[model samples]
Target chain A: MKRYMPLFVLPTLCAFILGFILPFIMGVGLSFCKFTTVTDAKFVGFSNYIKALQDTVFRHSFWYTALFTVVSLLVINVIAFALAMALTQKMRGTNIFRTIFFMPNLIGGIVLGYIWQLIFNGILAKYSTALALNEWYGFWGLIILVSWQQIGYMMIIYIAGLQAIPGDVLEAAQIDGATGWQRLWKVTVPMMMPSITICSFLSVTNGFKLFDQNLSLTAGEPGKMSEMMALNIYNTFYGRTGWEGVGQAKAVLFFILVVIIGVLQLRATRSKEVQQ
Target chain B: MKKKKVMPVLLAAAMTVGMFAGCGSNDAGTAGGSTQGAQGTQAADKSSGDGSVYYLNFKPEADEQWQILASEYTKETGVPVTVLTAASGEYEKTLKSEMAKTDAPTLFQVNGPVGLASWKDYCYDLSGADVTGQLTSEDFALKDGDQTLGIGYVIESYGIIYNKALLEKAGYTAADITNFASLKKVAEDITARKDELGFSAFTSAGMDGSSDWRFKTHLANLPIYYEYKADGIDNTDAIKGTYLDNYRQIWDLYINNATCDPKLLSTKTGDDAVAEFATEEAVFYQNGTWAYNDVKDLGDDNLGLLPIYIGVDGEENQGICTGTENYWCVNKNAAPEDIQATLDFMNWCVTSETGVNAMCKDMGFVIPFKSNLDSENVLVNAANDYLDAGKTPVTWNFTTMPSEEWKNGVGSALTAYAADQSDANWDAVKKAFVEGWATEAAAAK
Candidate 1:
């Protein structure tokens, strides 16, 4: 088995180098240059990073994305957990309810955004305003849209975690005069830490990396007040002329920020896991 | 046991090798197939060899006609002409990627001077070319120093398109409105009688992304044009916004007497406005000659254009805003033979009888070429009438707009203002127009 390891690993290693590592290295290099095309790049030191940091719009998007990530992470996880718990209980038609709840996750992000836009606009029309007219409206609109699309996906993960809990452990807790709430917190939750870690990591990263839904829903309208970091980076790269390097620099910073947050979240959640 | 272990190892090796072979064969198959297809086409007609034309067309509306024209050219000259039209609003991005390819576009388009700046390095000098000679005026040719970089192909005009019968029914005629004052009077009267008339004065001034360009860029051009006219300049680094107050009045009139509430305009699309004009729910729609196909079902006589009157001094002489953003540029990076072929093809497009008719009659373009044919488009004829009447056509200054971000900023501000219609909101629009422009202009530098 050890002798065949190199042969099996070679293909995946080559693919990773070609697809991810090479482009990532190139991206980091390009962030320090002024260029319209890669071939015409000229070294420009830290000017691009300076410009990216100095941009008020970019700073605003940073804070906006941070708040959005935190709120959406909490909302999606809580609702998903609740739904997972409910569906796991002994009940008829649980499969049907789960499938129905999970349907939105199957739809493309752009399609979901437009569908929700029509629905939201239809309801908001009675108030004589629209989702694109105000910043807060766009923010909350994105929250509702993302939650609607992502909650079911998280719910599936939570359900798997709930099902993986040993029945005997809960029975033991019940025989020991433990209440349902005590059993859930002391036994079920600590055992569910690994799944919680994965779920939180996914939700947080997804919240920060969101682009297509943000674009199709509002497109950072009402003076780009709702522009997230990814969309802002995209706009900087594509929308503005001569801002490609700054966009690349923003992307690098965004990558670092997400990594730090994800690592910290994983570490915090992993510590709470108890052995069965 | 050794034989069993060796059999599994061999199987694993075979599977891994098969995976690689699968990917390799797939790529090779597609590449070989494409080359074979190209060879098949080339073998069909072997004349006019070594100089195929590849035009990266900018306009999606004219794509089908361009394809027909390309095939026609190919049949006659036996030069393979490939026409690839970028999706609407994706031309710049497409052009950038395409230009980097080995077989880059031999022919492409630039919007105006601002568009030419980035592509200027790639543009072949059209000086002394037959196509440059065929241009109606030097103004239609975009030049940098001594070299002609691009030539304007089409001249489009936009104004207030009105329903002729509806105007007469409201006790008004095209001749009754000469300036902003009379236009305002007639529009206000129609609004006053809107309950009895069963139709509003103007179509909804939609602020959706699809519709907002009519206001943010085209409508915004009026103020920019007037400012330039006042400044006695063709281009400027910063705009003083001298005619913004007049801009305010025209915008206010459009929203106040429209088919829908001002607040509801944010969700209204271009199609909604066209539907309103087409169904006779509104009398006036703010659009251009390109809208002829959309509303021509109403008949030629029913369609008439009025120059957008934004209440300026001596403004009765203000003709429709007329200019071309579509300028054909030859790629300097292409092979010499391909360059000549592209040049010859362009000259033939404006010169040959089949080319002129296809462009004018079939495509509905008012091409700015000496050998251009008469267009049957009524809105185009109306625009020519204004020019013939000696009214000064407002040039398209929006082409000089610093960036798309500036346009989006203005559009967003305009959308917000339309929803609330407050003084503070209007101030924000002005700030977006003025400060946003300055910021973008500086950033572009």
Candidate 2:
């Protein structure tokens, strides 16, 4: 088996290098150059980066995305955890409830954005306003949209973690005269740290990389005040001529920021995991 | 146990080999299929003595007509012509990605000089081409120094399209409203009697993406046109919005007299406006000749075109806005035979009887070529009447707009102002129009 490792690994290695690694490297290189098409690139060094940073819209989107990620991460994880706890208590018809809750996750982001747009506009029309008229409306609209789509998925992960808890451990806590809340906090939560780490990491990263929902919901309307980082980069790349290099630079910076944040979050959460 | 171990190993080895075979066969299959396809086309081209044509069309509304025309041309001439239309509002993005392909478009279009700037290197000079000779006027040809980079194919006119029957019921004729002052008086009168008359003065000035271009680009063009006329310039890097107040009055008229609440305009669509006019729920609709198909059910005699009167000084002699954003250009990088074929096809499109009929009648386009046939479209005939009367048609200077981003900024400002109707919001619209233009223009440089 050991000797056959090279043969087994070669196919996947080739695909990874060709599909992901090469384009990623080329993208980073192009960030420092200005060109419409890849064949016509001319190196301009830090100018692209300077232009990206100088853009007030880009800066606004960065802060907007940061707040969105933090708020969404907390909301999604807390509600999903609570739902998982309730559903795992030998409740009747839990499967039906779980399926119903998870159905929204199966819908496409663009579709969800449009459906919710109609619903939100229909309600807001009573007030004689629209979602695109104000930035805060767009912000809260996206938050609600994303939370609806992602909460079900996170709940499934939490459910899996809950079901995996050893029965004997809870029995031991009970024998020690532990109450339900105490058993949950001391024994179950400590034991569930591994799952918590994985769930948090996924939710945090997903919150930052969100684009389709943000785009279809508001499209950075009311003068681009609702744009997030990913959508901002996309608009820069496609919407503005002579700004492709700046868009590429923004993408590279976005990648680095997401990576650093993801790493720090993993480290913080992984340290809390206790051995079974 | 040894047999089981060997069987599992054999299965694993087979699975890996199958994966390799799958990858290898896909590459080989595509390579062979494409080469075969290329050879087949080459053989057909050789037999026909002409290269194939691939036209990347810009208009989605005329896509079906283009497809039929292409098939007919191919049948008659034995030259393969493929037509692909980009989705509405996605032409530039589609063009950029398509131009990067190996089998890029042989024939394409640019909006105007600003659009031609990015694709200048890709454009084949049409100065001495047969299609260039067919153009009715040099004004329709986009030039760069000595080279004719593109030729305007369709001439479209946009203004306040009104229902003649509805206007008569409101006790006014088309002649009674020749300028802004009279137009305003009539519209205000209609609005005052809207409840009794069972129709409003104008359709909803929708601010949704589908309808906002009517205001942001077409309506916005009025101010730019007046400024350009004052400066005696065709294009400008920075705009002095001299006629913005006129723009404000026209916008105010449209929203205040409309069939819907101003606050709900952002949710309305182009379809809504057209429906309002077609169903006779409104007296006026701000759109172009292309909207004829949507509202033609009201009968030809009931329709008329009125020049958008925005209270400009010259006023009475102003015709409807008549210009084009669609300009055809052959790709310079195509094979020489393909380039020649594209040029020949373009000339045939403008010169041939079948082509002219298809364009003018079927597509309802007022083509800008010498062989252009008479249009049956009522709105088009109305436009020609304006031109015949020697009214100064406002040229489309909106083509020189810096970018789509600038339009969006102004559009949002306009929508916000529509919702609030405040001075500060109107000031924001002015800032977006003037300052955003300057910023975008400098960035484009």
Candidate 3:
């Protein structure tokens, strides 16, 4: 089996190299060069990186992305966990409720963004305001949109984790004079650490990576105030004529930030997970 | 272990199959290449009649007409023409990606000088091309040194599009408005009598992505045009903004007299403004000849084009801001055969009757070519009326606007001012306009 393992992994290994590694290497290489096209790229060294740092919009988008990620992670996980806990208990029409809660996740991101934009604009119109009128409006609108789209997905994961826990452990805790709140905080939550880690990681990364929703909803309106890291990088690449290298540099930085934060979060949460 | 061995084999076979499946599609693309053509001319050997043309069209509004025209040409000439229209506001991005493909677009567009500057290397010099001779004048051609990089395909004019019935009901006529003072009086009176008259002075100046160009690109042209004129120059590296005060005056009047709130301007879209004008909720809408089709249902007699009176001196003699941003530029990188075919096809489009009709009627375009002499669009006719009167046409100097980044910066500043209507905000807008221009120009260089 060990001798055959290499053969079994070869296909996937080839695919991973072709699809991810090659492009990533090329992307990193391109970050150091300046050219309209790949064939014409000339090495310009750290100038692109310097430009990315100097860009006020790029810096603003970093902070915006960080704030969005933190807020969305907290909001999404809390609500999703609550919904999952409720659904996991013996309840009427639990399947229907689960399906209903998860339906938004099925819709495409662009479609969700547009649908939410119309809904938000309709509501804001009453106050003689709109989603694009203010960055805060755009920010909250995105958080609401992301939560609506992702809560169901996180809830399902949480429900799976909840169901996986032994019933006897919970029953024993209850029998030992444990209150509902105490059992939830001490046993259930500690037991749900794995689920929390996954959900938090997903929501946090999703928040940072958000683009279509941000674009369709506000498109950095009220003057690029609501532009996130991904959107900022995209705008730099396509919107600015000569900033392709700088955009690539920003993208590399974004990739590093996401990876670091994702790893840190995994470590922080993984350490707290109880051994089965 | 046996099952695992079989599974790996199956997965590897599936992967091989998928690779072959992708290859199968590429084979189809080449085999079907006979049918998938563009602008009708890219084949190296023209006598074989296998020449195909791929035109990446810029105007989203004219896309349908272009598609119909391409098919019609293919049917007549036994040549295939493939027309791909980029969504509005995404042409540059689309062109960049498409041009990198093996079968790049033989025909594309450069908006103007600033756009030409970016794509100049790819542009096939049209100086000696067949279409060059067919041009009414070389004045509309964009020249980078000795090379004619692009030629204006259409001439458009933007001003105050007024609903005639609403204006007449307000007890005013076209004759009443000749300058800023008169235009102001009528708009202010109509606004003041809004309760009685049931219509406001102007439609909402939407600052949304779709409509911001109306203000940021077109309306902003008024100041740029005047400043260029006053400075006795056609284009400049850095604008002094001599007429920004006049720009502020017109913008203020627009917001103050409109039915919609100034703070709500950011939310109002171009469609909403069109609806307002079409439904007669407002008398004035600041748009261009392109909007003629959208508002034509209001009846020709009911619609009129007036100069955007921004209180510039000797402005009574000023015509509507007139010129074109769209220019046809052939890809220099394409094969010579494709280039020649593109040039021939471009000539045929302007010279042929079918092409002329489509441009003037379906697209509502005032083609700059000598072949298309007349246009039926009322706004176009109105523009001609201004030209015939010897009024100086405000050349679209905004074509030289440093870049989209600068335009966005200015747009943001303008929106902030529109929202707050403060002196400090106006100053910020001024700074974005003046200093931002120099900054962007330097960056572009």
Candidate 4:
């Protein structure tokens, strides 16, 4: 079994190289050139990256995306944990309620975005203004949308982690005369580190990578003040002239940021994992 | 603890499997190719009899007529004709991507100078061709010295389209207004009696891509006085601060005296503006000459279209905003046979009886051609009389080569103006207009 590790990893290795590594390499190489079509590209280095970094819109979008991700991570995890706590008990229709709550996650991001746009706008229309009228409306609108989409998924993870705790731990805590709050804060939560880590990682990464919903929801309206980082990178690459390399650089930076944060988080949470 | 780790890993594996399963096919690249069949694939697979013509038309109004011709061509020559129309204002972006495909539309529009530069690499010239004789003016030809890249199928005009009944109710006739003062006075009077007249002076002057042309092109033309003076002789660039103050005279009246709020109008969609104009809710529409056909169908004979007499120093010398509303340019990257087939179809449209008559009915008028349009085509003929009277038309500054970023930059500036009705915003528009031209000019370098 130990000797078959190479064979076991072969499929994933090939898929990763083909789908991610090759495209990334090609994208990086192409960033130095300027051409409408890939075959016709002409070398125009550093200029593209310089233009992108200097672009005021790209800078603004970076800040916007950072703010949105921080806010969304907090909201999604808190709600998911609460739901997971409620669902862990022996409740009626628990299975059905869990499935129902998870259904939104099954819907495609683009479809969900358009549907919510209709709902939000239909309500906002009475005021004779649109979601794009103000940046605050756009920010809160995206927060609500992302939270609604991701909460159930994180909840399921939290539930699984909660159930994995040993029954003896609770019994031992009761025998020690510990309160419910104290056990929840110490034993249960510390034991649940792995699940909390996974959920946090997903929510953070998803917040950073959000694209389709942002695109369909506002399309960076109110004069592009509400454009997020991913959408900003996309617009910069395609929308502006001589900015493709810069968008690519920004993407590279984004990858580094997410990786660093994810690694730090996993390290912090895994340190708290019990010796079970 | 072992179950906790194993179950989450299994779920992750399940999701990964599900994703790959959804995209099981190896050739996802080919999925983008199935649309608008290869430009000349039919021609290559078979003879000219089987050679299809794929025209990606920019003008939406010509769809019905093109449909008739496409069916007729297929019936007559056994070659299929597919005409695809872009939704209004999305033509440039559509053209760029559509031209990139392996089976992209064989025949696509390269309408003007901006289009000529952006698309010239992909455009095959039409110099000294049979279709060249069909144009009313050789001026419609978009060329880079010798490379005649595009020409007009139908030359359209633009100015003030108005409701004749609404004018009469305001105690005026078409004869009563021939210049800017009278037009402004009539608008003021009509606006004063808005409660009685059931409408205001002008329609909503939205500064979105849809209605900004009324300011950027038509109304802006009044100050330049149609002499093509914006950039001077051979200085092909957008109009800067040359006569921006003069442009403001009518623009102020347009937004302030209009029926709707400026901010509300800023947020209004194109459909709302067109609908309000069509329902006879307003007396005047600052639009192109192509509107005659749609306005006629509103079931009202009282609606009349004319050029605005907005104040110009030399008023009598000015006529309607006359030029090619759009142009037809063949794709240079196209297969030689398909390009020939497209040219054949184009020639047939201008020369053949059925094609000319069909275009006349569809486009609301016909261009000056050897085939000659039926005399009964009144809306277009009325527009032609303005050109025939020798009143110089608005020099469509469209022929000036703009950087590819020009349109988006202009759109952004115009959108800003719509949001905040301030002179500072107007100055930003001017800067974008001028600087954007210089930037694009530099890029094309």
Candidate 5:
């Protein structure tokens, strides 16, 4: 065990420090500094955080992201579960259909954004309006894009949960004269809680982390009406001069929000899981 | 039982330490590699040890030329050159990130005054070089006090480039568009039969990166041109914008009479509009001579450039949009050798006949150089004619500094007006324009 300890634990520790710990420390320090490069940072503490908290764009992004995540979370989980339930049943070419449905997730975010942009603009062309510069078009466009990309991935997870339920549970409910829907509600659903919990957690976290697609698709057109948290932080940091600290503050706030929401989601979902 | 239980915990502890050590090592390696690369860049020619030239290209159109130029320079000098071209519109942000590297490009472009100002602190000086003398004066030079930070490798001008064949085909000549009213009347007539002629009056007047040059700088010239003339001097940043109402006349005329759907203008660029003109779908495209390469293949004999006279008074004598572009400056941070090389290169480009001819051949450029700027190049010749005709040339007075706030602020306001043609939006545009200019001009550090 001692001999192999370095081999096994070394990679993860390195990953933590390199990917998370180091950058995190640097980022926190940067939130107080006003400068272009990290090394050249000039300490002007609290002002960056104050400005970040006060920014209308940052505040707007928080609300926008929250709304988007809630809406997408519900829609994605529902569609995924419905598809999972149907696919888990006896059916021909279920794997093929699953593969087909899940394929959208394989495409890169920037490419998906551009493809969706073309599709949206094509549809809007007949109406004599465009998706390129409008705000609502950007929001709905992101919604459609995210749902199309994530539903299949969540559906796969849901299928794993649905398949794990004991046949005896459903059989016992049937013997007790339960209707089909009743049996599903009493036996299958209760047993599928673990899968439902995990999928919900994943989709919710993913909604918070979203960036590339939002950037490529609309870039929050028509005065940033569709700007999300990640895009807002990026633009604030790089687009505005001397706003690095403010951008860093937004990032720290973002980290706190995601961590809180993620942990809360995990706890809530985990509590619903059946012992089995 | 105790030994067994403790095995995983012991293993995990060891793993954690190893992990941190491994990461620390990697960071040290990266930092070391960066330092070495920086040292190489600062070294002259042979000692650079895999040191190569990296260029972050803003013009996608110049990708081919850069590839050729880079390859030629490498073959000529035996210096390794790596050219990374930013697909158009990605230059500023990409360059910002790229410039922070330990192995930043030693030979990248310093395009304009605003661009120079943005990265002035990083440039190497080229002041006493032979290339410094090639310039007409300090007019095209960008300096940080005594240091010549950027040298114009090649300069360009923008105006209204027209399809003379289409004009002749429509029973008119390039000579006909002498005044604002004449230009407007002809454009409307041509646009009325856009189907028969298979063209329209103008291309998409979008306000994004490509097309905003038309609005923020070019089309706004009606107001600025008048302001420049009103004062009977050069470089007027102040404008009444009362004539901005007349600006709406030309703006409305261009937007309504254009071949493109205006709603898509937010995404359209000068490149897209020029593409339309090149394909002969639009009779007129507003852009700089930088666009000459894209259109030159259509045959220079058929292509004609008219001076921008959106609707200014005394418009008959107005010449093409007269301005300077793509100025070069040296880095204040460069080592003595690099500074010398940069100086040497600049002098070589301006004074050496080989350098000027090569620049002209590839760039089709108008140099500020007295000797070299005299070219068989008709575009440069025509630009000179505009200057010689005593027409007050409109410079890019707004770009005295590169402010993202000013660029996007002007763009945002112009975008709203382009959509609805509301006087309120125009007023908003003017407010954004004036206030943004005032703020940026004042805030420049």
Candidate 6:
């Protein structure tokens, strides 16, 4: 198998180098240069990085993305876990409930954003305000939208974890006079650590990487207040002429932030996992 | 074990076959493209053409007409003319990518002075070009020092597009709206009788991405235009808030007389605004000549353009905001043959019957070049009437707006102000305009 590994790995290695590694290197190089096109790039040192740091909107988006990630992680995992536990119980027609809950995940993000925008505006119109009226409105709107779209997916993972918990453990706890609540806290939760880790990591990264929904929702209306890190970088790249290098620098910073957070989260979660 | 061996062999065979197939198809595709190119050159060669014309048109709305014009020119003269239109609002990004290619466009568009500054390095001097000679007035030519960089293609105007029947029913006419005070009275009276007349004074000037440009870019032009006039300058490095009072007056009138609440403006859209005007739910809609096709069914006799009578001194001299931002620039970096081909194509567009008819009739453009055909666009006619009446048409200096980033900042500020109409909020909007412009200009430099 080891001898044949090179043949199997060659195709994927070639694709990764061509598709991801080359472009990523080029993009990193561009962050240090000033040019309209790659062919005309002129090295400009750290000026782009300096300009990117000076951008108030870019700084605001960093804190906004951090808060959003923490909030989304808590909300999505809690709701999804609750749903997963409830659905795992011997209830009539649990499949139908699960299917209905998960259906929103199938819709495209842009389409979902527009549909929710109309719904939000319709309700807000009664109060004579709108989604773009306030940054908090857009923030909360995005939270609800992302939670609605992702909860079912996380719930599926949690359900699988719940069912995998050995029946003998629950029976043994019952024989020892352990209550339902005690059994859940001691046995079920310990076993579900892996699922919780996966779900939380996913929601956190999704929160940070959000773009299309942010754009279609508020598009940083009310003075760029609700712009996430991705949208801010995009707007800087295309909206501000001659600032493409700074935008690229912002993108590189965003990539580093996401990578650091992801690795830290994985390590923290892995530490809490029980042997089971 | 047998399955694994067989699968690997099959995969290898499939990969070899796929490689061969890919090579074959690439050869075929290139073969077809070169033949088309050869045919195009043959046609150009027959008609004293030196090179083929590759036009990167900016307007998506007129894409069909441009495609027809390209094909027609190719058929007539055997010159290979290709027209590729970028989606609206994506022209700058598209042009940036396309200009990096080997076969870059011979012809492209610049919004006005600001756009010219960005592309000045690539712009061919049209001072001695035949197309420059065909231009009706040299005033429409965009100059960089002694070099003619771009020539205006079409002149368009925008203002308060009112329903003539609705205005008459309210006991008002276009002549009554000579100033801000009179225009306000007419809109107020009509809005006061909205229930009886079955139409309000103004359509919803939505602050959504689609509709906000009407206010942010066009309506904002009123104050910018007056300030430029007062300062005796065509462009400025930084603007003082001299005409913001007039801007506020006009904005206040628009929001107060509209069919939707100011808070709800963020939810509304340009399409909704157009629908309200088309369905006669509103008496006034703020838009430009391009909207003629959308609202012409309201009847040519019943539709007219009125000056945006923001309370400025000498308001009677104001006409509809009329100017050309759509200027054509040939690429100097292109091969000389291609440049000459582009020049010839532009001259033919102005002087030839087919090109003139396509631009004036099919696309509803009021060409600034010396074309014989009269434009059939009713909005153009309305603008021409204002010019004949000796009204000084307000120039669209918004084209020279510092940057798109500045526009977005102002747009966001405007939306915020619309949501909460207060002195503090308006100050923020004003700051975003004045300060944002300075910041963007410095950044652009």
TM-score of each: 0.93, 0.93, 0.93, 0.79, 0.86, 0.93
lDDT of each: 0.87, 0.87, 0.85, 0.70, 0.70, 0.85
Colliding pairs, model 6: B43-B78, B44-B78
Off by over 4 Å in 5: B1-60, B63-87, B144-147, B207-243, B267-275, B370-381, B435-445
Q: On lDDT, who's better, 1 or 6?
A: 1
Candidate 6 lDDT over residue span A141-202, tens digit each: 99999999999999999999999888998999999999999998998898899998999889
lDDT of 3 by residue, B334-409 (tens): 8777787678778878999998888877887888888775777889899889999999888898888988888998
TM-score of 2: 0.93
lDDT at B62, model 2: 78
Per-residue CA lDDT of candidate 4, range A19-53, in tens?
89987887777777765544446788777667667
Residue range B1-445, candidate 5, lDDT tens digits: 7778577777677767766776554321132222122112212254665434544455565556555655555565565544456545555655555566654545556556666655776777666667677677787776667877776656666777788887887778877878778888889898777888877888888765546767766576566556656777644244445566666677777787787776667767666786788888887877667666678767777777777666666777666665565665554454455455545555555665665666666656677776665555556566777889787666655445335655666766777677767678778877876676666554443
lDDT tens digits, residues B1-445, model 2? 6666677567667866776776664321122111122111221353465687878888877777887888788877878886777777677766776676666778989999888887888899999899999999999999999999999999999999999999999999998997899998999999999899999999999988889999999999999999898899988888988888888999988999999989988888898998999999999999999998999999999999999989888779999999999999999998998898899889999999889988988888999999888889999999999999999898998999998788999999999999999999999999999999999998877
What are the chain B TM-scores of all models? 0.91, 0.90, 0.92, 0.81, 0.78, 0.91
Better of 1 and 2 by DockQ: 1
- Local accuracy of candidate 3 as per-residue lDDT tens digits, A1-276: 577677667766776887799979988999999867554577999999998999998899989889999999999999999999999889899999999999999999888888898898888878877777689999999999999999999999999999999999999999999999999999999999999999999988898899998888888977789999998999888765677888899999999999999999999999999987
Worst 10 residues of 5 chain B by lDDT: B33-42
Question: At residue B254, what lDDT does model 6 achieve?
Answer: 90
Score chain B of candidate 5 by TM-score: 0.78
Candidate 1, residues B1-445: lDDT per residue as tens digits?
6877888678767876866775564321122111222211221242456687888877778777887888888888878777777777777866766676666778989999888876788899999999999888999999899899999999999999999999999999999999999999999999999999999999999988789999999999999998887888987768777888888899999999999989988788999999999999999999999999999999998999999999999999999999999999999988999898899899889999889989998898999999888889999999999999999998998999988889999998888888888999999989999988899888877
Q: Give i-RMS (Å) per prediction.
A: 2.6, 2.8, 2.2, 6.2, 4.2, 2.5
* Two-chain complex of model 4, DockQ on C-alpha atoms against the true structure: 0.17
Model 4, span B1-445: residue lDDT tens:
7666676567657766765875464321122222332121222224544355778767666656666677787777776677766655556655655665665667777657755655667778889778877776767677788878887666666777777887788789877777777777888888889998898878887654456556655565455443345445534544454655556566766766677765555445555567777887888877765665557655446756576665667766667766664678887777777788888888888888788878776555556566756544344555567778887666665545354355555555655665566999878766766677676666554
The weakest ten consecutive residues by lDDT in model 4 chain B span B26-35
Model 3: pairs clashing at backbone N, Cα or C within 3 Å = B37-B81, B37-B82, B38-B53, B38-B54, B38-B81, B38-B82, B42-B52, B43-B51
lDDT agreement of model 1 with the native? 0.87
RMSD of each: 3.6, 4.0, 3.4, 6.4, 5.3, 3.9
